[model samples]
Structures are given as C-alpha cells and as structure tokens.
Target: MKLTIVSRNPKSTKFPVTLELAGTASTIKTSDVNKALAAKFPKYYPDRQRLTTEDKKVLDLDKTLEEQGINEQSSIYFKDLGAQIGWRTVFMIEYAGPILIHPIFYYLSKFIYGSSFTHSPMQTVTYYMVMAHFFKRELETVFVHRFSHGTMPFRNVFKNSAHYWLLSGANLAFWVYGPWFAQGRAAAVRNDVWIYGSVAVWAWAELSNLITHITLRNLRPPGTRVRAIPYGYGFDLVSCPNYFFEFLAWTVVCFLTTSWSAFLFNIVATGQMYVWAVKKHKNYKKEFKDYPRNRTSMFPFIA
Candidate 1:
C-alpha cells in the first residue's frame, strides 16, 4: 500500500512524502507506518512520530491502520515530537545519583559533626538501607522494568534527576546523619520493637515491589507494545500495586527514622505516586472493558 505523510509540526520540513508500505491496510499497524516514515526520514524515529488522520484524529500505535480508517494512498499528518531520550537512560541517571550522593553525606558526617561524631545504630543501619535500596533500583532499571514508552522528552531528564537527587539523595542523607539523628536514640533503644518491625515491613515491601515489576514485565511480549489487565500478586487488589508497595517502603523509612525530613519526603512522594496511580487506573478501565471492578487505584478497598 502507498501512503502520504504530511508534516503537521511547524519544525519539520521533510514531509509531503509518499512511501510504499509492505502490509495490506488491515495488517499494517500505526507503528508500522511510523517505521516506514522513519526509514525514509532519518531524523524522525518511531518513538518521536505521532500519526494522525486527515481530520487530525490521533491514531493508536497498537491498532491496525484499517481499524483507524486509513487506507491505500491515504494522507496522514506526522507530528515530530522533538528531542527524545531512551527510557532506560533516564532511570539509570536518576538512580545513579542517590547511590553516590547518599554515601558522600554518610562519610562527610565525620567532618560535619566534628571528630567526636559517631554513627548511631539507626544511622549505620539506614546508611546500608539507603545504599541497598538505590542499588536495587539501578539493577531493576537494567534488568526488570519494561517501559511501554520507549523514550521521553530529553528535557525531562533534569526535572526527574532533580527530584531523586535532591529529595532522596541530598535532603534525605543530611537529615539521617545530621545532629538531630541522635536526639531520640536513647528512647529508640528502649523501643527496639519499632525498629525491627519497620525493617521487616520495608523488606517485605521491597520484595513485593519487585514481584509486581516481574508480573508487569511478563504481561508484554518482547519487542511489542501489547497491554493486558494485570492480575495476581498485589495486582488483584489495586491497579497499581507497584506504587502501593513503593509508598509502603518509604513510609517504613519515615517511621524508622522519626525525622521530619523523612516524613516530608514520604508525603511528597506519596502524593506524586497517587496521581500517577490514578491516571494509570483510569487508563486501564478505559482500555479494558472488563477491567476488574473491585480494584482501586493504588490502595486496596479504599482509593
């Protein structure tokens, strides 16, 4: 089939080009059209192309061209989404900062608190906890996460990096090892149960979060953008169990640290995660007619 691509973006000048695509209109996907265009226009990658009908109606990449009413010799508008970065690269950069920044503060505590400064048991444990948590995130970014979107706007990297580096890295590290860290140690010693309980919950939440990631990964086949209703593990209770578990883990950290900064970070993170979870839940219901009726957005039984 032959198709014509007209540039809708004012920044692009290469369009009004006709290209031959290999499948019948029924067999060719929107993604296929994007690929065909990308092959001819080197600057327009598949991830950076947005296809629309003559009426400017968006075409879903997961659906076939026929489903979207596109046919032989059809003209579609191509909007170039500028300046993209791979999803994996974004996660790596953001997670890598916390791993290094946390430790730098941990060691600098010696100088910050003077030579007599020593780590309280909670500080020592949290130092290791912070390291392990971020290291696991880095490993998962490489081995576990399967992103539905291949790339994001390149400029978002700074905003994303600042969120992780400033909140989780610098702000968290300073509070955990700062002067206020030892103020409650004597009381904490008397209540070992809180420490042990929080640690246990944190560990369980971390493991469950990983399980949710694996479940999500298994939902899509390799090299495809297929989506399905997720079930099992924590998914049965909520549309986004991963976010639930992530919030739980951070809440545990806040409880263990008993620091005002830790609590503030937890609140900020939870608010952000809740917004994302609600959007994902809405999408799931919209995309799947039979999406589970009992499931909440991120909380079980209570949204």
Candidate 2:
C-alpha cells in the first residue's frame, strides 16, 4: 500500500512511501508508519512522536492507520503539538484559576452564609488581600513574565487549574471567611496588633514580588531565551526572591487569619517553591560561571 506523508508547512516537500500489507492479518499502527518516516526522513521527523495530524481535524496517534480510515494514497500531515496551546494560554489559565475560584467562595460566605460586612471587617480585608494577590498574578502573567517555551502539554492546564482552584477554595472559605462569621466581630478584632502587622507584611511582600518579576522579565528581549544572573532587588540575597516573597505573603495571611487551613496551605506551598528554587539555583550555577555563590535557594541565609 502506498501512502503520502505531508508536511503542515506548505513550502515543505511531501513524500510517498510503500508499505507491505501482504504478510499478516495485523493492521499497521501509527508507530510503524512513524518508524518508516524516521528512517526515510530522519531530519524532518527526528522525534516520530510529533509526526501526526488529521488535515480535516485531529488524528489519534494510538489508532492504526487503517482504523483511522487512512488508506492507500491518503495524506497524513505532520504537525508539532507545541504550536497548539501557547505559553500565554498556559499562564492565563493558571493565574485565572485562583482569581475566579477565590472570589466565588468569598462572596458565597457573605451572601449564602449570611456573613455580612458588619459581622467582621477583618474578613473583608482578608478577602480583598487574597483577590489582590491573584489579580496581581494574572497581570504579571500577561505583562511581566517571559516564557521560554511557546507551549506546554494541554493536560497541564487542567492539572494546574485543579491545584489552584481547589486549594484557594479550601483556604479562603474555611480559614479566612468562615471563621470570621462563626466567631463574630469581637473575636475577629481581638488580635489588633497581629492583624495590622501581617497586613503590612503582606503588602510589602506583594510589592517586592512584583518588582522581582519585572526585573527578571526585563533581563531578556521578546522571543529570546537568554538567561542572565539576576541582580538587585531581593536577588542579591536569594536566588529565587520571587518565591521567597510569595512564601512571606502567604505566611502573613496565615498569621492574620489565624487559620490552620491557611497555615497548612502555606507549608505545602512554601515547601514546593523551596524545592523548585533549589533546583533552579543549581541550574543557574551550572549554566553561568559568574552566578553568585552566596545566594541561597529561596531564603536570605537559610534554605
């Protein structure tokens, strides 16, 4: 059987190949065709896993060519999956998850649970702070951050959405909002010093995080993947100042709300950020000879 392999790019040349179908009853799989394409055009399809498409729609790579209704003389186009969902889409979805999810639970506590503003003003402040943090993240995703790759796996969007949305709902609803309603205005306002101090810290951390992100974004030109040793701001003290500031922001929220849910969320989030920062710091040291040796992974003087 003869099949035509087409490149998605119109300028690129196409080729025809013959497959032997006389031997057995088994159908020819996409993997078999991919191997044949690699052998014939090694430069074109260096990674055969990326060689797939349905000109009319999307092709399932797991299916046999015959099972997919692909017959002799059928043209299967080659496409790169990375082009489907770009980096902007990934960041937008990730940042939007928390922004959308947090507000729903926050408002629901007020309207559905009858936790009005007079009951606790501190709850209002906490609600606004959470919204502000996620809103800033969404703005940063659009304007401040520079992504190295054009796209990520499509499934990652769902995974990331679930992580942020579920966590935000649990943290904000139970700890930040629900407790204030249950305890009333007196209990909420009892910790005047702690509440005010945490709010101040949260504000400072949020500002510092934004500055660090902007500094990092300005380091490289648009569409370029150049990585430079970050300096100034909090970078002089820590390799991942952004992560450190983020940890501080959440820690302050935990203190202000006095919620175990908030505390546990902070612990888990900070641990993950620390691990990522450590790996990134090692990569920076390995990649750049002049990368600072004094800077810790996330903290100023400690890991």
Candidate 3:
C-alpha cells in the first residue's frame, strides 16, 4: 500500500511525501500514530491525537483508518512550518479528560423514573407505531451516541459537563424506551391524552431541539479552540436563545407524551439543563460585562 503524506505549515511550507506499507485496518490506532511519531520525530513529538488547527479544525484519530476511508493509495496532508508537526498530528488517546457524568445521570434517572416494566410506557407501548419512526430520527440525531454508537462532538463534552449530562441523559432515556426498547418485543410507550394535542406538543418540542442544534452547528461549529463546546460565542448576549428553545422543546415533549414516565423523564432532564443554562447566562453577563442588559435570563419578561 502506498500512502502519501503532505505537510504544509501555516508558514506556507508544504512537503508531500509518500510511504509504502503493507498492513490491515487492525494495525492502525492512535497508538500506532504515536509510535510512528516517536520513530518519525522522536525528539519533540507532540500529541498528534489532537490535530486541531489554529482555527480549530480537528480530525478524529480514533476513527478506524478504514472507517476514515483512507486507502493505501490515500494521501494524508499536513502543514510544515520548518518543524515536525508531531504534537499536532501524532494521535494519542489521552485519558486526561474528566470522568464523564453519564453514570450519575443514569442512576438518578432510574431512581426518579422508576424501573421500566415489560409493558411500561417506556417499553414503547403504543405510540402510533409510525410516530415512533419519526421520533426515531430525532433520537438518532440528538441522542445518537447511545443508539448508533457514533461519536459526540468533542467540544461539546469538554465545554460544559452539566450541559453534557442533561443532553446525554435525555437522549439515553428517550432511546431506552423508544425504538431501542420497543424493538423486537412490542411498543411499550403510549398516551391516552388528547391525541393530537399530546403528539403535537412533543413534536413541537423536538422541532425546537432540531432548530437549536441547527443554529449552533451553523454558527459555532464543532471545531473551535475557545471551548470544547464552542462557548464565547458572545452569542450569549441574546440570553441563551438555545436554552429557551431547548426548554420549550423538552417541556412540550412532556406535554405530548402525557405518559407520566416520559413526562417525568423530560421534566427532570430538561429542567436540570434549564438551570445550567440560566447559570451560564449569568456567567456570560459577568464575563462580557457589556452583555446586553436588556436581554432576559430566559423568557423576555424575566421569570
């Protein structure tokens, strides 16, 4: 297999070199990269696992080289600045990150929502069967990690643990009872309330969630150095537009589900998020100082 390596530094230096190697996907790992870095630039080998640009363009090294679709004939590009970009390109799986709060939220949820039954609403009882399909898309996008085994935005996790806890927890719970739980067996989730009103409420909430995610993805992007979660948007001046919309989205989902199980899950889940967002909003006010004083904490009237 012939691999091409391109090195170009911000200083406008570019060197493209190709190497020949015979190996399978199993041989490629961040560790392998580190080893290559040690051999390639043993002196001042920086971490390549975090190949983030000054502007915050990051490449996930954990992705299976094959998964990255890098063929033997593939070409890898790098920036050369009269120096070895070891630290910037050498992929190392550093466990330096804080222990995530996923477990805490999970146990807390099990306690508050109670254990699910074979026929529990969380088991995907009878949610119009088809809506489950639509909700499936929402779950895949929002709480994707749990169901799809996909990666979350690296920045989102590093930015705010509290926010991460809320979003991750909510996504887990929703998937647990929905398609994932309801599959093979039967749909365990159902609502006897005003059918349209209830479903509409949930849909509206999900709609808002989608909207906020779209806004953030477009505005802040996932690869910014300011924060793992892309803060300092000074976008804070609007007083957590994301938070307000997020709250409404989850609250309306509770209304739609009408099932006490789902309602309780979203209420507690989103309520926790609301608190974090409000606190972050205040922090923004303090940090920016010039943060528009007219903006309300959450709602326009300031509840």
Candidate 4:
C-alpha cells in the first residue's frame, strides 16, 4: 500500500512524501508512520516533536494503521502536537474532579464510623456551600468562560484532578463530618458578628466571581478569536478579578468552617490561581497595547 503524508504548513514548498508499505503487516501502527516521518525529515520531526491530524486530533499511536482505515493513495495531513490537549477537555476534567468527588466525602461521613445521617446547621450550610461552589464551577465551564484556541498538556488533567479531588475530600470530610466538625462550628459561631460577617463575605465573593466571569465571557463572542480588555466589575482593579473573587470565596469558606483543612485548601488553591493570574496578566499586557497598566495580576494594588 502507498500513502501520502502532507505538512500543514502553507508556505512549505516541499513535496508530499509517499510511503510504500506492506498492506498485510498486522501490527502496523501510527507510531510506525511517525518514525518513518522522523527518519525521512530529521529537521522537521525532531526527537520531542509529535504529529497530529490537520484538525488537531491526536492520533492513537498504539492503534494499528489498518484499523485507523489508512488505505492506498490516502493523504494524511500532519501538524505539530506541541504538548497539549483540548482546552474544553481540560476544564471539563478539572471541574468534574471536584464535582464528582466532593459529594462522596460529604455523604460517606454520614454512613461510616457510627456517624448519624443528621447534620447540624453549620454542617448543612458548609455542605451546601461546597456543593454550590463546585456546581457553579461546572456551569461556568460550560457557559461562562471563553477558552482560546489551544490545549494544555494531556498529562495536566491527571495532576489537576488529583489536586482538586483530594482537596475537596479533605476539606469536606474534616470540616463537615469528622472530629473537627463540632469544634470548628463552635469557633465559627463564638461571636455572632464573625458568623454574620463571614457569611456575607462569602456570598459577596461568590456573586462577584460569577459577575466577573460573565463579563469576561461577553468580551469575546462565540466562534470568534478577538480579545478585548474586560471592563467593569472587579476587572477595573485586577487583571484576573475572577481569580481574585475565587480566592476570596475560598478564604471565606475557611472562616465559615474554622477548619484547618479548609484553610490549607484555600492556601494551596490561591497559590495556584495566583500563578495562573500572573501569567494571564502578562499575556494580556503583551497582546494589547491599551491594556490597563495600573491593574494588578490578582491582588489589587499589592501583587
């Protein structure tokens, strides 16, 4: 069988390379084609580079080429994989981790270790808050965020899922149903002023985060690549106000639960958000000449 491999680069003058191979090779794989390409064009297909279809679909390297339906005189366009996965897939997996895992820890505590199904007011509120937070995140992943054209590394889904799922389980288990639950609730309500203040702050942060996300979504229409500076709401002060509100919301969770686990989760999450915010802020500045110079990355006037 003969197959033609074409490069996606429009400016390239190089002729398409043809490969002649035995059609009866039972174990022929995509990796074999990749190896052939690398061997044929050493400068283009270097050691670390990967090739994908023209539409950016990653080929199953281990699947047999025959099974993928490559036949004689077929043309396959190859482009760089560039160490990434689809952005929608990334967000879906990341949000799904917490959405699916949090409920297990929240409810499991009730059935295990002689714990009752009944929950205290504080416990109920914290449980609902955690559920609401992750639900909103899932909804935002579908409706409120615009992802640029690209992918993150395929491996990052595992790393991100582990981080979110583990933290969700830890925070909910320790704060809502574990031995620390009673003590944490006691500390939270020791002063009515503190309880009311923390609840108000949490609500405000959650709503503000949603608004910021909506504002960002509105900046770019669906199926368009144009990027404009986001205005109004929290965007006035910070380049990544959505992240700022997210950090604030988690911090408020720590206060509401008075749980060390919640505090630790907030700290770790905030650190990760901060890193992302900084990178995004720099990118905004680099991409737009009119980007607000006075805006910070995450913290207003501090970071």
Candidate 5:
C-alpha cells in the first residue's frame, strides 16, 4: 500500500505514494507503525507497542496524507519517520534483536565492574548471566536455519525438525541453565591475584566480546550494507586474534571466579571457536592461493 510521508525535519519534504513493503513489514495494521514510532522515540509517546487506530486502518508514513487523499476521518497518523527498521527484516538473519540489545552494553559492563569493585559474588554472577544470555540468543539465531520451528511452525519448514529441537535445547541450557556453569572452581588457597585477575579477565573479555561481536557480526549496523565474511578467519590467521583476545579476557575471569564452572565452560566454548578459526583459516588459504603468508591465526606479525 502507498504510504503518505512527512518530515519533522525541515530538510526533507513530504510525498505520497504506495511503496511496497519488502522484508520491511511483517504485518501492518496501523498498530505496528505506532509501535515502531514508540520504540524509537519513547520519550515522545507512551505505550509504543500498543498504539493503533480505533477503526484499525493502517497509515503509511512514506507518503503525505494529502497525496493519499487521507481524510481526517482516517484513524492513523502519519509520523515523521517509519520504523528505522522493520520487525520482518529484524528476524531475517540480520538484526532485530541486536538493535534492541546494543543499548545496554555499557550498563552491563558497568554492572560487572561495579560488582567487581565490591568483590561481591552476587553482582559478578549477574553480570556473566547477561553475557551467556545474549550469546545464547546469537547462537540460536545463527543456527536458526537448522530449526524448523517458529511461533507457528509451517509444515513446509519441517525439514530441520531435529535441528529445531537441538536449538531449543541449547536455548534452554544457555539462557536458563547457563549460570550454573559460569561459577568458577573453588580453591583452598585463594590468592588476591586470582580473585581480582578473574574479575579483570571477565570484565575486559566481555567488553571486547561486545565490540568484536558487534563490529564483526552485526549484520545491519546503522547504515552499513556489507555483511561480515568471517574476515578474521579468511585472512589465514588461525588463532583469530579475535578469539584469542576473548580467551585472554576470559582467563582472567576464571581467576576471579575461582570455579570449575567457568573453566569447563571456557574449555568447551573457546575450544570450539579456536577449532573453527583454524579451519576457517585453512579454508581461506585453500580458497585463495594468494592468502597472506605473514599472518598467524591468533598472534600478529613476527611470522
């Protein structure tokens, strides 16, 4: 349907025309538009997700009401902006959840460090909980194709029913049961070095994790049009400085956490990333004969 567009910004002009929603809208009933506006500008309006027309007529923001011959009687209002992103596009192997989640990284980091200051087991524990929670979602999203289920599972998508169940199990384990594993091992001789060191490792590692994950993995970051090619691996860097840095960061976390829980977790998790990085590096060399000869997998330069 053609949407009427207007701008709160003076530089932009209003237009009226029907623009096809291409991976841009899951469903529009005027309610979705209001929800979009509210999410992006919560300060201006309340109950963002609940905004809709009384009679249920959807309004198009891409065109002006005049262009569409919109009558005042029409229930929907044409706002200055459309959804910065559509919910449909968010679910399409890209970034519906990340965009929503990115805003809280600072707070997460703060919480971790703040708890680390007190050396409180409770606060530090909560910090790692969020990481595994987010990481778990990323894992599920990355492997979503393996799963054949959605909110409503279609028969046509049943090919990966097994993968679906497996993903569901992972989701439960990581998000729900992930914390039980984050706790580090107990030691009879607890040194201040180990305690603070683990806290430092977890704090920085997660911070770096946020950065690399966002930069390398974020699909629809702001205005960028290019997708990540798993570049660190394709460069023939076997250790993948990214994964290495992550390990370095987490090693410290293990010290502070002082539990077999974290040790076992990193052993499995980082080990998988390491193996994948090596294979990816090798694949890069095989695929491109001219792969960089000087680069090592995890370490930089010095051949």
Candidate 6:
C-alpha cells in the first residue's frame, strides 16, 4: 500500500511520502500500518494520527485493511492531530474546578450576596454536598474509572472544565446560596423537610452512580481496547446508569434548593447525557449481537 501523510505544517516534510507494505494487505491491521508509518516518520504516532481515505472517510484503527476495502494499491491520507492530553488528566481538571469554585463562592458569599445577607443552614448543607460530589468525582477519576481512549485533544480540557466550573460550580453555588434564595428559605419548616428528604435520595443516587462506574470499569480490562455488553446492578435499568443517577442527583438538588440555576444546569446536563446515551445505545446494538433488546438509553421506556 502507498500511504500519504498530510502535514499540518507545509514546511515540515517533503510532502506525502510513499510507503510500501511488507505483508499481505488482508493480514495488516490499520493500527499496524500506523506503527509502520510512525517507524519511518517518527513524528506521526498511532495515537496522534487520524487516518482517512482520499475522499475524507476516517479510518478505524481497530479493523484490518481488508475489512476497510483497502488494498496494496490504495492510498490513504494521514492527518496529524496536534498535542494530546491524558483522559485522566482531563477528568481531574474538570472535576477539580467544581471542588475549588464551589468553596470560593460559599466563603465569599458576603461579597457576592452583600453584607446584609445571612447564611442559612441550607446553604451550609448545599456547600457540603457540592464539595462532596466533586471530591468523589475526583477520586473516581484517579482510581475507579478506566477509559478506553487513553488521550484526547489537549484543547478539550478547557471545554470540559468550563462545563463543570461554570454550571456545577459557579452557577449552582451562586444562586443556591444567594440573598434571593435566602428569602425563599422563609418557609423554614417546609424547606427543612424537603432538604432532609432530598439528601437521602441524593445519597442513594451518588452511591448508585459509583457502582455503575465500577461496573463499567470492569467491563474493559486494563491495557485493552475491548468493549462488552454491561449487565447487572444499574445496567439492568438503563444503558447509561451513571447518567441516570447523575441526573437524579442534580434533579434532587434543583428541587431541594428551588434554584433556577440548579434547574438550568440539570436540564443542560440531561440533554447532553441523553445524546451520549443514545449514541452509546446505538453503538452497543451495532457492536454486539447479543446486546439486550429491551434496554433503552438513559431513561426507561419513555426515552
């Protein structure tokens, strides 16, 4: 096969270089081809390369050349995907923002909500919940979750961090503990009942979310890019049990706090999670013939 590598910088190489394969096209995996290219070029590592056809159809690294309809005479274009960041690092950065930002807003409430505003007991409870939620996420990022894709584009760290930092941290904390919300806490008896009841539900959601993450981590062993149908525990209820529980937790927060910011964040997160769940559910059906027929995405039968 003659492979062509398109440089991001025009001055880098002498244009696309032709490579001759040493083995039968049917036997060579797309990943093996990237290894050979990396060997000759030393710059385009397999993980950093985004291979595509002449017509711009992206190639799957997991499949063989024969499966992709490529032969000895076919030409493929290699695009260099800039700097990469570890998935763990991206997750850590994203979760860390919420942990720090939530506390900052809580402590600086006098400045943000003015000197007249008095802190409510519910505010203290909310502060603790926000801290615990992000801290647990940080712990999971470090030890529990196992990612199939080791790295992603480095630029994605900013985007991912912004979501957690802006919505879950700043928006959630600012409104829930603000003076406007303190006025609503006037119904102290009713508020206490809702807050305490929701705390129990939130605790259950958080624990279930952790369990689903562990189940997913076990599905793919370390150092392998294998995928399997997830079963048992929360998986029996929804395709993305983690998402369902996460949504449940946030929904509980929104109801307990009665804050528009919390409700907005929950809505945005649910929309994003539903999109991801739908994609994952579709992929499971496509990849595994034995995938559960009755399994929906994040929701039960309604989705």
The number of the candidate with the highest TM-score is 1
lDDT of 3 by residue, 1-303 (tens): 455555545453333445544566555643344345446555424342233322444434555456655666555555322232222111111111111333333334455446543334433322332244234434434433111112333343434443333343344344444333432444333445544464566566555545554545554334432312223332344455656655665455454434465455556656666687688667766777566666665554663
Question: lDDT of each structure?
Answer: 0.86, 0.73, 0.44, 0.73, 0.42, 0.82
Residue 85 miss distance in model 3 (angstroms): 22
- Steric clash pairs (candidate 1): none
Q: Candidate 3's C-alpha lDDT?
A: 0.44
* Two-way TM-score contest, 1 vs 5, winner: 1
**Model 4: residues >4 Å from true position, as ranges?**
1-85, 183-192
lDDT of 4 at 10: 72
Cα TM-score of candidate 5 = 0.36
What lDDT tens digits, residue by residue, belong to model 2 across residues 109-215?
66655545543656777778888998898888888889865566665677766656667655555556664544555557646777677789999999999999999
Candidate 2 at residue 6, lDDT? 68
lDDT of 1 by residue, 156-256 (tens): 99999998899988888888887656535563342568767878888999999999999999999988888999999999999999999999998888877
Best by lDDT: 1
Per-residue CA lDDT of candidate 5, range 143-253, in tens? 422221112222322333322222322232223223332235232234556555556666665565554554454444443333334444323443366676666665554
Ranking by lDDT: 1, 6, 4, 2, 3, 5
Badly placed stretches (over 4 Å) of model 6 are 1-14, 20-22, 183-191
Per-residue error (Å), model 4, residue 30: 24
**Candidate 2's error at 118, in angstroms?**
4.5
Residue pairs clashing in model 4 are: none
Model 6 root-mean-square deviation: 2.5
Q: Between candidates 3 and 6, name the one with more favorable TM-score.
A: 6
